[model samples]
Target chain A: MGDYALEVTNLTKKFSDFTLDDISFKLPKGYIMGFVGRNGAGKTTTINLITSLYHKDAGEVRIDGNRAEDDKVLYKESIGYIGDESYFHEAFKIKDIVSIQKDFYPTFREAQYMQYIEQWELPTDKKIGEFSKGMKVKLMFAGVLARDTRILLLDEATSGLDPITRDEVLVMLQKYIEDGERSVLFSTHILEDLEKIADYVFFIEKGGEVFCDYKDQIMEAYRMVKGGTDELTSELEKEIIGLQKSSVGFQGIVSREVGDTIGDKFLVEQPAINDIIVAFQKNMGGNHTWVQ
Target chain B: MKIVISNHSELPIYAQVKEQIKEQIMTGVILEGTKLPSIRQLAKDLKISVITITRAYSELESEGYIATMQGKGSVVLGRDNDLLREQYLRRIEEALETAIETARFLKLSNEELIDMLGNLIDDE
Candidate 1:
């Protein structure tokens, strides 16, 4: 009914130390939004809240126009979630797990499941614990792909995978959303993969949202400015968002507008998503120091 | 046409796609009336999002490099010499702008910079 496959409005959760402060964004149907953040940046917490594994302290999460909290079964059925760790019992075989999943999800297609298993070359009789980490991840993907799910919430699903396997998975994700009725929220620190496949980006830092925008817009809006230390005027310093200083020069991020005002005094380069995130983290007074 | 995207490059993925396709079209690598892959097919092949491919294709269509038909996929349009010349000139101007800036920063004389350019051209 709604254009957005997944929507979160002012979602918040508090812990003893960190708080996910008013996280909000929407994943439009048929697009992938890369969810990026540093370690312990509440990415998992937000994913947990969306899956209804953790009750939200405030706000709402809507999956395909259904309230995630009110319609738990429908919400859960709509989303195919894959986390960093596998939750299957160690003694369970792949076939056993598939049968169990079919019972829980009415839309699960056994033929599709078998097709994926054959395509992925996963062993049906192999014990879950006997599979390698990569094999386990593939198994998880195979299960999710066989279900008629509308939304996929992947939390660092590809980190354990090799480069070749990761590329395959990325291709699989692209194919999954080809129908124009599905959406994905993929959370990972691998900005390169995001650069390849993500239409939009949602960046978080220390449990707070930094920004959310179309990937191309972000690339055009922010620039990496580098210049001699002597050229760094107080006015220019004031314009930068994430300023890193060294004896030779100062490098920082500034909007294209501010970059225009500085003119040729500094060398301006396009900022990657990784660059933007690192700059923001440094600006937040995180432990990372600018290397150069 | 084959397009390779570099994630580490300064240009955005869509920009890269647009530029590469334009290059192929200008060089006649992609002939007129050639049927380019559909957005979904290209996205799947490149391991990129459909929206990104759509953006690139839309830009190409707007620039007259490609045309989209009703049910059929996009087809490469006949080359426009003026447009191709303009594209080449813009690239040369960008390169010269950076070259001039660096030369000025190094306090190189106009004659010296010209001589250097001449030598490089001769060598090439």
Candidate 2:
């Protein structure tokens, strides 16, 4: 038994067209880890495996130190999974969904549920089908928060949300972990939000673990190098992770350790989380310093 | 304490938090022995990650500006601490050096610069 709230060790899953490689990362209690990758990068596969929606071919998911196979009910009760799926009937209203969900989560707090509904202005009178996509996503968050789950698995839950609503959800996630006993694993393409709120960033590429470390550490690892076309030497080109060249200039991500080798003339800037993800895919193979 | 973090700043978010808190401590805005907000609360308030706040607080502790206790979240340290005084002295020197450089750019005499400094201190 470890101290992590959610631990995924060598989680491997296979499908007809793709395979989720040996992915492993531990999100300790009281923190939020952003699970990020390109569209087909197996982010959803990993989250699904963690939530037991998809049976993993290999690897174990331990929710608060208890495996899914150990105690089914206990494991399920400890975690809440919120994906883009509505998980509600088309004709059901907010109250109808609550009545059904109350039967499932014994730890459910109706007051908390009402509070979120009130805060988000979720319509209690309208059928679930009448809600907008963003509204549905907010409703999912409200429902999940009502269930006092120790670990939250969010898969693309914030994609449809508007900026204001997204910020609110981020704040709510922060509040959820204020007690230091809860943790969240949020997967989304919105790297900007993750920059402000994610403690750790677990990035994958083509169904493989690219890097999983503290958000600060990951940010510290790489730099964006921009230089004139005339300044691009063979040595400098080799140092770049995802080198791209145009008629006027060239820009790419380079390891911070590669700073000394890069001449003072080149413009070295901090790479954002999104920049790293995008540049990584442009790499022409060979540079693998991002591991660990 | 009021902390304004600029997303456009060249400094990293954690470093910004550390610098802002350090400034508040040195400037007497947050008095000594006063309790700082809990790391979680500050993160929530700032809309930043808890890890970033944790980093900022640890840096402050190591620099002797704040101390974290068991029950108490974090308390501002006294300014009399040698390390704190040294940091303040160094910052003051840096600020003075910048002022002198600007004065030189304007071709101001030493007497003129000192007179300007006197007026600024008087205004404060």
Candidate 3:
């Protein structure tokens, strides 16, 4: 009913040790949003809540502007989930998965399913257990795409994949949203994948939202600052995030606006996604009030 | 049309796409009525997000360099006189940025650089 294909507002889930606190983000139709954080950063917890696998303590999730509570069938029809683990039985053959899919999804297209199977070179005779990690990922994608689901939720789907397999997965994600009718929420700790294809990034830290913005804006928002250790005075240290000291110099992530105002007093360079994430972890104690 | 993207560049990926396409269109390297690669096709080829190409194409459409017909892909527009002038001016700005960078590296004062430019032109 809205432009967004997926919307989660104030989504919270609690467990004994951890609470996924106030996780909120929207994936607009026709785009991919990388749901990123380190391991134990609640990335999977948030995905579970989004898929309604876990009961939420608060907030709601809407798929295509319809809540699961409001329209269960429609919500279910709209999503395809690809977890890091194989959903099928280890003994199940490709045809077994296909038959199961046909029973579950009314929109399943057998021809499309077979086409992807052949295209990805997935063997029909082999059991799921015989498949390599890349082959398993392809098989999962083969199932998900055949259902013609409009939104895809991939949780750590690329972690164990080799580089070539990851590239294949990235291409699949790009292809999925080509029509501008679909969206994807890909949760992974792998920043390399996110950097290549994420339209928006929702970075979670310690069960809380750290920052969410367009991928371009995220890259442009901060700078890596470097200077001699003395230049990193106590007063100056307050301005930087995750400040690090060596015998020769110190380097840290600094707010770009602040970096600019400080002029050339420090060497400011562009930061990679890894730099930003690491800096966040290092400076967690120092208050990231500056990170938007 | 050919596009080369450099990760080291400060220009965002989308902006790089837009500028390159704009340059090609203005210079007639990409001709009028040329069908630009569909957004998805470009993204796959460039190994970038579809959003980046979408942003680039939309910006191109808004700037009147190209037109997107529903269901069909974008196609370049006929040249405009004012737009052509603006494009040429952009080339000069880019050239000057390089010149300025070199001058600064050499520690040439702004005035000295301007005087050098004047002397070179007068000698020509």
Candidate 4:
């Protein structure tokens, strides 16, 4: 148990080829956290462990202060989750799926469901198999929204949805945040999406946590310093956690503490989340950072 | 409101957002009192952090381009186009001054600079 809507401590899960090593993080209640990583960066594995699909080899997972294993069904009841892949019955109509969810979530809102169905224009009568990937995503989201769960865990929820559908989902998620008690832990490779709504961010690579901080903290603490390659001596380069050189020059992440060290010769500017991700990977090695 | 975002632009995310809204207000894409998207919506649309969008909106409001109301979201304030144009031109002139200084430093002659400008305009 931890002081968060969701908390995982030293969670490790191993498969034949991949191992999620000692993963840990926290999503404080009411904050939307973007769980960021490249594909195969253990984003899905972490989500699975949280949802109790895969038992952790060693770790503690608590949702709303209850150990996830104490009462798996009750713990799941307080959380609404959408996996990286849709898991509804192929033969079920969107309406049928909604009904099934209604049976499960005590706090399910029929009116909200109706409104979302109308807002998203989801074809309720159409079988789940007949829905386009985007439509299926909408259905999944609408259903989740109706649950009114205390915490929402989404794994790549926007991966395949069209831009419009993606925005619609974001709007609905924002609406869900109206209570100020609900929280979300969303994992995705799309840094752009995280940039949109995430108040907190956690970056996972090679099965361990790499970066975890408030969105504003990251923005304020790190900067992108651009300078001519010749200007970047090893001493100056060491001031930056990540550095990359191009034909034009060099760009890298420098802590604000090192600003005076680098001086005014370089263009010091804030780096985008995507740029930060790339810089973090470069810091690890020129190759992909997380997966071996 | 014709908003131009250079995908390769060096401007910060907040600055880009501020400029886009400024353009919208100046060009009438967003009329005075027109309700703009919520901070969350703007962030999603721009694919930027809420903090970034919040800074942009706050800066815009302070500059009189927009006003934010609780629950109502940000709204355009009907800025004077003349004011906006003057600001835009001043920025361009400053950039041009820097460029001219650089050109002079590089010893580019008037004729060579004119030829370069002509080629650049033609490409545009």
- For this target, which candidate reaches the highest lDDT against the unseen true structure? 2
Lowest lDDT 10-mer window, candidate 3 chain A?
A283-292
Model 3: how far residue A229 lies from native, Å? 3.2
Worst 10 residues of 4 chain A by lDDT: A283-292
For the second chain, the TM-scores of the candidates in order are: 0.67, 0.75, 0.67, 0.59
The candidates' DockQ values read: 0.49, 0.68, 0.56, 0.17
Give the per-residue lDDT of model 1 (tens digit) for A1-292.
7999998999999999999999999988989999998899999999999999998899999988889657778888898999887778889998798779879999888898888888888888789899888888888988898888889999999998899898888888888888778999999988889877888888888898877888767777788899999888998887776788899998988888877766677788888768877777767764332221
Q: Write the per-residue lDDT of candidate 3 for residues A1-292, one digit (tens) a residue.
A: 7899999999988899998898888889989998877889898988887777788999999988989898778778888999898877899999998888888899999999999899889999999999988888888888888887879999999988988888888988888888888899999878888888888888888999888888877787888888998877787788788888999999988888877766578888778877887788777757776355
The residue-by-residue lDDT of candidate 4 on A176-291, one tens digit each, is 65445677888887777776578788888888888788775676667778899888888777667667789889888877667645657788876777878777876765432322
lDDT (tens digit, per residue) of candidate 2 on A26-84: 99999999988889889888887887878999999898899989988888888878887
Model 1 clashes, total count: 0
Q: What is the TM-score of each candidate against the true structure?
A: 0.80, 0.90, 0.86, 0.69
Which clashing pairs does model 4 show? A206-A290
lDDT scores of the candidates, listed in order? 0.86, 0.87, 0.86, 0.76
Task: Say which docking band candidate 2 falls in.
Answer: medium
Which of the CAPRI classes, incorrect, acceptable, medium or high, describes model 3? Answer: medium
DockQ of 3: 0.56
DockQ-based CAPRI category assigned to the predicted complex of candidate 1: acceptable
* Residue A108 alpha-carbon offset, candidate 2, angstroms: 1.3
